[model samples]
Target: MAAAAAMHISTEFINLKPNIWKKPDRASGSCCLGSDDISRKRKLPILLFDVMDTIVRDPFYHDVPAFFGMPMKELLECKHPMAWIEFEKGLIDEEELARKFFIDGRDFDLEGLKDCMRSGYSYLDGMQELLHTLAADDFEIHAFTNYPIWYNIIEDKLKLSAYLSWTFCSCISGKRKPDPDFYLEVVGHLGVEPCDCIFIDDRPTNVKCAIEIGMGGLCFQNAESLAKDLSHLGIDLSVPNI
Candidate 1:
């Protein structure tokens, strides 16, 4: 009976048998199944992508120091993390942070720094292409990032705004990654079930959190590998080069 039911339903909608294993309580009017099963059954839309180190390379490690006329070693030695932390908490304005990092006592031109951050930041190869392809296919693409100051700048400069439907940043949202609250807030704000969204991040902890919230997640390595992996999930990746 279970096999028959499983075969009858569309795999895209739900890939399980209803009442084959166990029936739900009369009050609920639905069988109790795992989130994975429920998500497939419900057929939700939405793909959540992590920004830093996933779509774009680590900007701080590569973009910031070089643009600010400081060596990577010097920038790393400076206590920027605490400032960033405060910025993420909404205690400091993004513009203020940028001013502190790139303007105050910095010999580099502010406009040049902005330009470098905008255009010089390297994105994962084929990422823009893949995202465009996905969006063209009617998949809603959202970017979730920990970086607050440069999110809009990078997106605008890279021409990613066209492909990305919306962007969620910890700086703007006042929520950091790897925290269930951040993911929950996003899912709730988007009015989608956790299972309906597929989250990709470079960090395992974030992926684990997504999974725990009943969302599909993949740990990203590179654009080529991620494209291949998404293929298994029925997402085609024939986007044109950006």
Candidate 2:
């Protein structure tokens, strides 16, 4: 596992298949770095960003309920509680989700729901430009989101890899944020200390967990506020001109 992880970092382009099949081992202090690699690791802090409400406009709250013609509370009562979590953890696929979406197993318009979700997937204000700026500065960035396989839909519409790789998504990693092991595994795979990373999420609990593990964390309110926070942490957000 360590060798595979090392090979992944050694490569010029990231291969998602290897990572999907063989995720990193649990972090026991460290895993993949050699002495030579350690010297080359330090530069800009690596950014791990949450998707959904942090970077993209999640439709679950408003658009989903609207599509179902119900309020959020009513939808919650009708939905299967663990089904979504299972999907995020990659334990289930879309077909399974559609089958088990409602608590009573009552069928709804699955395709219509998916279409609604896809249509509502868009970048939040200022995020696109902010991501571009971070990319321009050569800061390493990866999506550290707790989303399901439907993240591909987001990628298809937005092409988020233009700014950051969809690297640490729960669907691929089989782990979610606030799970300490997930964060540790990410650190292990990156071969970096917790202090070397900054995790950004809209959820305070998620950010809290990352900070508790020694990574710099910010509960994102907006891109402007996030930029200010990053600057305060001594991050260089200035984009270099071509």
Candidate 3:
């Protein structure tokens, strides 16, 4: 099994595929860098960004029950904390919960609910410009999020599909952040060593998890503060003010 796994990775590294989401002519280069090749080749730094509170302010209004035509205060006052606990554990789907609470309650319009959710979502200041700067510098930027198909909703609402090289969501992979295996899976998929990647997340535990797996990690506070921190780490983030 180990040998087969090695062979699979070897194939992925050798037969680099194209970035289907990007331009048809552009190729997804191998993520591996050998000792000899590392010296000769310009090592492209990979930046893994967290979604939600890291890149965007997670507005509470979006999750409010009132948006779904339910009593917000009443739902909050309910003593069933286990429901939220189960939700966080991925035992319950967000859409399904919304349907059970709101859609089945009355004349709930799915499109309207989506629009309200999107309207409450706001981008972090300077994020768009930061992304452009990183892309211009030839750095490979990707997103790692716990959000499920909700990433699709964010992509459509923010129109950020073009700025990112790829996005990995736990919903798609059946894996959650702060897990060593989750980070390892991403490294395996990218065909890169842990040392070649840098991950930025808002949560300290998540950052610590990445570090435990041998990847460089950054704890994000704000975009401005993060830019200063990245600059100290030799990353040139000279983008115009957003």
Leading candidate by TM-score: 2
Clashes of 3: 0
In every candidate, how many clashes are there?
A: 2, 0, 0
Q: List the residue pairs that clash in candidate 3.
A: none
**Candidate 2 residue lDDT tens string, 1-242:** 01111222323222111111111133543422445455365444788999988899988877988998998778877888788888888999989998988989988898998899999999998899889998888889999988888899999999999999998988888988779999999998887767768888876667777877877778788888777777777764753321
Superposed Cα deviation of residue 154, candidate 1 (Å): 1.6
Off by over 4 Å in 2: 1-37, 238-242
lDDT of 2: 0.77
Higher-ranked by TM-score: 1 or 3:
1
- How high is the CA lDDT of each candidate model? 0.64, 0.77, 0.62
How many angstroms is residue 212 displaced in model 2 relative to the true structure, after the best TM-score fit? Answer: 1.1
Residue 77, model 3, lDDT: 43
Q: Residue 238 of model 3: what lDDT?
A: 75
Q: What TM-score goes with each of the models?
A: 0.71, 0.83, 0.71
Model 1 lDDT per residue over 113-134, tens place: 5676666566788887788778
Residues 106-139, candidate 3, lDDT per residue (tens digit)? Answer: 3356577567667767778888788777877777
Query: What TM-score number comes out for model 2?
Result: 0.83
Instruction: Determine which window of 10 residues in candidate 2 has minimal summed lDDT.
Output: 15-24
